[model samples]
Target: MNTINTHFRLSYQIQDEAFKLSQAGNCNLYVAISSRAMRLAVADVERNKFVALEDYELITVFTPLQIAEQLRLIADQSPILQEQRWLDVRISVSNQFFTLVPETLFDPTHQEDYLRLHSNLDPQQHVILYNRTFGLDAVNIFAIDGVIYRMAQSVFPERTVQFTHQTSSLIKSVLHQTDRNAGRVMHLFVERNYVTVLVVDENGLQFCNVFHYLSPEDFIYFVIFVMQEQKMNPEQETITAWGDITPDSSLFNMLKKYIRQVKFGKRPADVGYSYKFDDLFDHRYFELFSLHFCE
Candidate 1:
């Protein structure tokens, strides 16, 4: 990982020798946004492979206007993001303003009502939206910061940018990666200040939620709590993890200290990645890369 100190620290960047700036029109751009970080990946559609990536870390928590400013700054300076000719652009907004409602109980006219039950929405500040979870029989009702949403739309003015919640991508990716015939398993995606826990069984998506924590102890408490609530035994049930974690990191160590079958996750098997990505941990960009599977 290479770090370039700037408005937002460039934590990691890698581009394949085959990637070409002029051919961006044939590529798909995937961007993941959060309070603590922003990341983008470029995939060459004709080749069906990811060709480049840029991961940026925010120094501090940012509000709507501040996040919009950061997005503007990054778009102005980023080599790949500045291009407006992408074949498609999909963005995953990572925030606590999303809730899942069973498809049978969902009503399109009541999107705001569904989200209001879980998040405090300001009509002027956030734009409420929804994404259908294929095969899961649920819809993810979410609110994206209006400033940030407009900035993202401005970033790619020519095409209709597809916006989705980060958990939506995680659900699509995890369900694709897990063995449907196998027993239930818990998947955790650890970000800077929060952890998203997803439990999948042979039937389909069982449980999915995010927990904020300030320390390693706080992190494990949520993990164990989810396990107990799902009737999963930490001693025997498998817990696979991905994102912002390393084998020697405090989070991983703590997970092992508690859960006996802790394991690191891998990249989505369906999408091909450039050899340039070999230097990265397989689990690091799971959500960003999984955007390929997002509708």
Candidate 2:
């Protein structure tokens, strides 16, 4: 019963159990029944199909005897898998024993040599680089067209020229990996203790912010300051706060009022204006701005 096109290794005994599980309809649940044993079964109810074993692009099932027979089969029968075996390909950090080639054919020392050879050939499409100190953590958020996409965490102690240069290089790598080169308006939220950064474009939004402070006002102020410093037009940008705080939380209530005050009336004389505590906490009084304003 071979339906999925992913490839990986499993013992003959486990493969027998997977075949039974696949037939039992348990494969549709997307649950792993056992971790100690290497087994995978995927059953798509919509398609009424099942695959007892999978890797990334190879899937097949054979009886315990057949599996053993295939282990001795020449590598030509599994062309793509054979190439992956020669290259010492690994799907992920886990599943170390899972290899494209049979265990008998594996050379432990050669694996490292092959990996080094291919490492430079297949550089990551995107790279993110940033530096941080031991005590403080920074969160980076990226959004495109009002939708959130990715978040990253970094630690920063002091601002050094080398650190700044490294961060710039990392940003370039990320952009290259994502294949996005268009101008993107980015925002940085820096509080006394931590910093949050946002990157936004037309596609959607991605948020990365740390939870160092409990107050939402601190987060909002940081966002506003970043926008102003970057010279982004307030009218053209959208800011969505993300973290442990929810939209209906008290902090969000204050933010709604703050946004209104900033956008609607004359700029206040006080750099950081204070609103009545009662008014700030009134959830009914705060209406979420519509998409026309945010989008």
Candidate 3:
């Protein structure tokens, strides 16, 4: 439950006093939850404005019970949790699940069976099932797990919130942002223990997979392996990186050594953010910000 990374800020710190005094009834709160951390961003929805309000990363833990307890404690202390209007929450699970089923046969009743066929673990430990309703009765549904779901619901009303795998938001944002004329696009959302690689062309998603890493080499290997297996040429394809990455992180340097375009992504252009969050890295917290458009 100890804090591994903590950075929480409010409007008055970054906004002019006049702006802070007048921010009522105009905002929406968005949260992105994962095993390693939790991030909160508040946006004045009517104005398309946003500011990342806080970030909390948990210290190393040995068990799921510890992880869940730590996550709840972090939520218990956030003042934003007390404000319940216009909330959108996304829970990220590391389960690498993808199923191709037709819409006619896609019954919500079969959710557990589909995931169970692919994963050999206790469903009691992970009880969340989320899918994309925006696509053509298409194949490839996602299943997310862990304490993030329960923690999210525990803090906010389940009826008023939207839930999906983190990749749903990541893929949604990247597809809209990627330039189709450019041919191929590769996006990497790097986190502490996981790296999600999403690849696409003008046609649509050519590949999507998440890899867990124990070292810098493992990270680079997955990057190269996907590009290789997908027949994407690193020399020609554009790779737009985002998420918890920084200019100095070894993940950045490792990608630079092998690829041509390992640049960071721009914040969603459709959303306006307060100058209060200017101190943050522009490329980070993208999924949390893009959750503004989830509904």
Candidate 4:
């Protein structure tokens, strides 16, 4: 069955043979929406494994209203999303307008002030929200277009919705996987037009930021620049990559040429996936899968 709305194309839809729409009450739903893409992942708590996923890629940059309309179309056709009741529903927004503040200095009332330092947010057009880091002493201040938030609310009006930023999901998953004894680890999460670089070490979250790149050269430049700024050696330390990249892709090849040890990352180990998922790359849909770890 093809479910391609004019605005967005369904790239892939995978589900376990045993997944049942009637049993959605036992499943948790995660929906991640960004300007360029939208994704859905379903985890079955009863089986401790992910049972379904639907990934969509947008042809062009979409405004908040356009994104919401596409989401509504997906909701109308996706069997997994058609169910009225689910055990849990979490939505994450991926955008450039976000900033992280240490919990010690975070004032809930000054969220807009904190975020303004990094990106501009129009109160009338965007909603300012924050999510506390799972294992770190920080708060991620981010914005979601009002149109998108309201659309999600309308789609799942019967269920309580939890909102978060894509960065929150990446940081939580990286922190959980970081081994204190391992010294320092850098992760590159490649999106359609941007890359999120995260640096964590024995001490704590050392650095996290996003950089937009237009070419493979620009992509590797940002990677190497961040390593230099952090005093890491590309010829020595290992970097793990996730999302929007294939092993034989030009992006991966560029990384390998510049860095001595580059490897693909796997999903969170705590959660399992159905055998059906084995056909896919473990590194793909990391931010969506990592949402499972969000509070």
Candidate 5:
């Protein structure tokens, strides 16, 4: 523990009855990978209910391989890691290289071309993925380190196939919960060092991107910039938010100062939660909880 940066021990054992049900191989493992935090959760695949969850804050950043080794260690230590269920990996890396390409023209084999849209595509260090998260007739091409992907697979094996962008699933979660039958809306997911902004209407996803920030000033700047880029008026558009957000936080206070319609989002209505989870913040952990809606 001395060499590690910030290791917050995560422990949540389900009740005897819940443990028996989970042992039936009915739960799926959801892991959120990021430089800021690594969170794990178990959900009933059949009923889409949240069973238990835990997280770690990685204050001391390490090489991607080092982080992978840490994750393998975590998987090895968890009692439920051996369960025969799927492992869903959500990418929340700080640097995002993404582009929207038409589905008809998007070739999975040509994923690197789209990754090149943002920067010089790095094949050796980065692995690329072309995904159709939004229902639009287009696919998003993005990349993370190859080491991270392989490390996750090595831990979970054949059960780990679903890979997706953080913004994609969070956008879907927001849309699924919002009454989008009316008008265009915006949403934000704020973490300690990063902020993700998304705008959508009845049509589909309008804009999605992640920005890195060190101070509260930098945080609100990016949020407002996204709104302006999307031509969304803060007064008219509702901006629902979650993940490391609070009404009293400097970030939220700045958001409310400018955006009249700003408010905290809710958990997905379809999922059930254990009483143990009641102690966690409702405004946070939406990314971990929203993994249920990823599929």
Candidate 6:
């Protein structure tokens, strides 16, 4: 049997952070910095091992500056490495402050590239939209394909079909019956103050807007408005909340209270996907642990 070899290299300064590298192939190299001292040490290493001795076949230096001059020198001497895309140029900044920078500053084309990269990386990507307010808690919407599925407001390990299916049908009915073309709605995510809805079919994800509302009524109104703008009907749609609601002060009950409060009128229908929050991840653990010392 013949083995295939692959390598990936990444470099970052103390201020910079890399979320995750693409694992498209077998080889990966990641270099991150924590302090000014580390950055200086990296610079020294680049000068000696990278520049003077030329010890490695692939070398990428992550620095604050683009260093066009240094890149030119490296490209001239290290033709093979440059041809292999071994060099990555990046800026160094504090991790705390970097997130504060608007996406436009890093790259004007960040959104396009971000979506493309994510789509390529995870073809079966499931989107979850969550929002939390004082009286109105979190509403999570998971989008798979063009269909939006709702997750329970609270996170649970075990899958519950009642909330998931109900939420899916509600959104499906709303979108299908309404004038809004599902194809136009591109991406959706939850942000701090509001739910950021992106619609990018032919027009691209640029036309989408953030809907800001303090209450669930207002939030629903905003959804209606978007639907109406695209010509969706108000009467034809129903919004139902899903998740487990317990009989006692249990996982099921808590989720039930939340769903009833937001969805209105409808009672939670049991779909046989219920489980204790503690026993959600591994039910066998709960069972085994319970029987460990019992007679």
lDDT for residue 65 in candidate 4, whole number 0-100: 83
Give candidate 1 misplaced runs (Cα > 4 Å).
Answer: 1-6
- What clash count goes with each model? 0, 30, 0, 0, 0, 18
lDDT of 4 by residue, 1-295 (tens): 7454567789998989899888798989999998888899999988879999999887764578888888888788787777768889999998888998989999999999999899977889999999897888889999999989999998898899999999999989988887878888899999977999999899978989899899999999999999999999988999999999998999999999999999999989899998889988989999999999896
Which lDDT tens digits does candidate 6 get at residues 1-295?
A: 5242212122221211221122112211111111111111011112111111111112333332222223233334432223322222111111111111122243433433433432332334343221111111212222222111221111112222122211222232223222344344422222212433333333223233445555545545555566567543334433322211123423324323333322322211221111221232221111111111111
Against the unseen true structure, what C-alpha lDDT does each candidate score? 0.90, 0.28, 0.68, 0.89, 0.71, 0.25
* 2 versus 3: better TM-score goes to: 3
* Model 5 lDDT per residue over 18-100, tens place: 64434436667777877667776777666667776767666456578767766666666665555555445444443466777
Q: Which residue ranges in model 2 land beyond 4 Å of their true spot? A: 1-195, 200-214, 260-295
lDDT of 2 by residue, 196-282 (tens): 354545442333233234466775676666667656555665444322234565655655654442211111111121222122322
List TM-scores for all candidates, in order. Answer: 0.96, 0.25, 0.84, 0.96, 0.87, 0.22
Pick by lDDT: 1 or 6, better one: 1
Whole-model alpha-carbon lDDT for candidate 6: 0.25
What clash pairs does model 5 have? Answer: none
In terms of TM-score, which candidate is stronger, 4 or 6? 4
RMSD of 2: 22.1
Against the hidden true structure, what lDDT does model 4 obtain? 0.89
The candidate 1 region of ten consecutive residues with least summed lDDT is 1-10
Report the lDDT tens digits of candidate 1 across residue range 139-236: 99999999999999998888899999999999998998899887888999999889999999999999988898999999999999999999999989
Q: What local lDDT does model 3 show for residue 176?
A: 72
- Whole-model alpha-carbon lDDT for candidate 5: 0.71
